[model samples]
Target: MSQDPGLWTVLLAMIAGAIRVSTPFLFVSLGECLTEKSGRINLGLEGTLIFGAMSAYATAYTTGSPWLGVLVAGFAGLSLGVLHGLLCNLPRINDVAVGIALMLFGTGLAFFFGKPFIQPAAPRLPGIPLGDWTGNPAIASALDINPLFFVGAGLALVMAWGFKTTRWGLIVRMVGDSAAAARAMGYSLGQVRLICTALGGFLSGIGGSFLSLSYPGSWNEGLSSGQGLIAVALVIFARWNPLRCFVAALLFGGAGALGPALQSIGISQGYYLFNAAPYILTLLIMIASVSPKRSLKDAPSELSITR
Candidate 1:
């Protein structure tokens, strides 16, 4: 009773899926890249992401403004980032441990507060009609684009340039490379790390907003699906370069879109397994990137994962 989609249709569907799925990955990896550049890590971004989704949905539902929801989500993430930074700065504090704790705390808080708003519908973000001129319903639907993807792409370019040309970029790299050297240059280690981590959280929060406001476009406990944690590996896969992070996110997004793409062409026997592609790719990347002989060439010297 149904006609099969052509090869081109399937390819187009995957491309669309990649564009839609990669936005969150792009934002999260960039956030991690910035935080790690300043010699800190925020594992708690997972929690920040979930909480941001809930808050964004709640705000959009209440105020009838999706943009306002996105803003609130970023600030919510910033607050969590600040908390993680402060706790990590205490004497004998371990960044990894602090991050894990904050992750749990943030997740718990989000679930507790996000209950009532679960059933309510929120205003969703609008999509750009990139394929409207095609005049084909399937093609147009496949090419419907979200504005956040462009924002994430633009931010990646700006971040890459900023790291190379800005004064603050110099400080973040200095601190990441050698805390002693940064101190000698009159930079406060805690201050630099704190600021970068907070900004990272802000970006990640915005990424989370994209999930609830766009793709799945709804808020639920299972909305994140561990994307926040996967993004940490994504940052490493990118080797701390903002531009590389962008590419890596697209790669991961493509892998994630594989199953649905196949399903679109009537290949459904291994659909669930196909969905595991991203995780498999993450594991492979970790294996390839790590070496017993030497650390990653571009890894921050002061980064705990490297040291």
Candidate 2:
């Protein structure tokens, strides 16, 4: 920490960047939170992320409106989510395999369409002022401060409340915890999973859109480097709670931004090592979440992936 700058400065930068960078994770993880809570996994979000980025970029460029691009990206992601749901409903189509296939398909599709736009920049998401507390320009400069960051925060609050107080959240949780129990209650597993999967895809696609059309503001082959997978990992770190997801996204976001922040302050500090922060932290969280035997006992009983 000292090699880069003052600890507080680094911390400040991390907090700010975390808000911006973590928006994608917040969106994707929260969506996965919903999917996993429904006793299903959509590893295909990795693909959705890339596809959404490409779709969003193309739409925003063609129409000259980034917001529209975001919408298109969500719909594109929903299509994949629906496909995953439909396939998973089939007798022998494993969800994991479908997810991997989607990842390849989405990435390939993104690359094919993204090649032309690689050199162009799209309009970015609008930003709101929340840094009035500081008189220093450095603080403001360190954080891009996008509107979606706050949207993500607000979303967490809404989702957390909904899960606790709404009938749908309860039913989804029930379905995830015990399929037999959910079936006993006359709930259609296929319907619930499909709806939830589509919703998840929509959210994940928006997350991907945020990366290309907002924070990063450009398209390239390396635009996203495993953020989708890290977000899936974030689901476990967050313990299936939307509120925890907000915090965890910021934490991972901070880790991800550390390298860039250091570089901004004239510190390289083994860029490769710092770049691994998000992945390393994710692995640690997975180990902790899985190591505790009691967590499983407390987890949704029908979650086969965790079991």
Candidate 3:
């Protein structure tokens, strides 16, 4: 605990903001977790994320129901993932190249649909009352945590357990690690990747829903601002562990908020540098996680790229 009231207040606010802000990253990272664990990388998650945000905003605006928007966004994400998976399945195509192409396509589609969504105000998400114990307005604002935050945390817990304990989890991991082994055991690797890719897309789509329907309550070209890319980075930092995703997301969120936090205190140094927080974190984590030795030894033998 800090003796300074203002510093303590800022710290508390950061904690609450981290929870609210990490929701989208949590969902998107979890989605990537599935895709990566199944021996594929969806670089198109960036595009998928934007398209999902646009789709969710548009659906919610049109239907007057936030839940429907979320489902529709998920389906849109699924469609994009399926397309990417199908393309990656082609013999001459590379998964990374396919991802790049899908990223362009997904973003283009989002901008197109986002035309009408810029002005629409869909139903905003209801946040949890985290400061009901205090009657002060500052406390309430500082403690307003989003429901998506808790949902994301719960999903992380579920995914971690699912990966370590379930039959489906075992099969996915096996297929990713070694297609030859999976084939020897009479498993279909392509099918496994397809399922995981679709699931990943679904989760990414839900992440988009969190952005447009909750944070901004509107859609635009800049709504995401590279959150999709950040999510991809978060997955690696998590070491493929879902629980760690939540913590990593919060860490990144705090980094993302550092600029704003400083401006509030009238000390705005290194503002531009703050803008690079997520990217810097991503690069550092990637460098740390990837290696010539560990990658060669620990990466899935059947993975087409890492090898």
Candidate 4:
């Protein structure tokens, strides 16, 4: 059977868009999932994402190596994550508050340092053509997957396994579930949380790298568009499951792609509303995930917001 040209084009665009847009979401959600698994939340990842984008673009422009740019972005994110961890560890400090401050700081730094790179070109990440054998340009283009996507998928699988079997994963889960128990077991709460937060930041940075080096393939002020914040909500929706987080990120990516896909098919009316699909999806997901009778069943017990 054959499909209408417009419908086929829209479907193809959405498929491609879902893959392209999901990269950042996947990485950020994974990072958030890891941090939450250790009983910490970093809302400042929005900053991390922006900063990573700037850092990656700048480094790629200077070094002519997109991979190097990705690496530097991760380091930049690690720095922010470390700062957040240190601040939150201080007596009477709140994680949420520190995260907000860091978010602002990261965004400011990105804007300041990113000014010169605004007009410069950077190396882009290489993509793999998964649908090469199909002999269809649209299919080939839609399947032109970047390496980072595979990395994110592998990480999700590994995380799912590690959480159930690895010693460190068990420790992280224990720490997140009950601080008192983790403390009783001779674990340092601050240390664990700090490491996880930094790791989360690093992953988020890579997500940012995917932005500047891959899709949209440029450095800009509005690069992130709240993907980082949505990641936190995604973690909640995923119930802190790494595999589920991957699926949730794709769902969001697909939602984000809807507007562009519709436009590609000449559906111009309500274009702005279509563009707001991701945010709307986020709100709806949050609402559906919540319950008045009790807390989310899978939330980490030691998370301050949940308690």
Per-candidate Cα lDDT values, in order, are 0.90, 0.85, 0.82, 0.92
- Across residues 186-277, which tens digit of lDDT does each residue of candidate 3 receive? 98777888888988998899899988988756788988888988898787677677888888999988877666665555657888897677
Q: After superposition, how far is residue 231 of candidate 2 from its true place, in Å?
A: 1.1
Model 2, span 44-115: residue lDDT tens? 888899889889998998889999999999999999999888988898677788888888888898898889
lDDT of predicted model 4: 0.92
RMSD of each: 1.8, 2.4, 2.1, 1.5
Clashing pairs in 4: none
Q: Cα deviation of 131 in candidate 3 (Å)?
A: 0.9
Off by over 4 Å in 3: 1-3, 294-298
**lDDT for 30 (candidate 1):** 94
Order of all candidates by lDDT, from best down to worst?
Answer: 4, 1, 2, 3
What's the CA error at residue 53 for candidate 2, in Å? 0.9
Clashes of each: 0, 0, 0, 0
Off by over 4 Å in 4: 1-3, 292-295
Q: Estimate each model's TM-score.
A: 0.97, 0.92, 0.93, 0.96
In angstroms, how far off is 5's CA in candidate 2? 8.4
For residues 102-159, what per-residue lDDT tens digits would candidate 4 score against the true structure? 9999999999999999998998998998989999987898789999988999999999
Candidate with more favorable, higher lDDT: 1 or 4: 4
Task: Predict model 3's lDDT versus the native.
Answer: 0.82
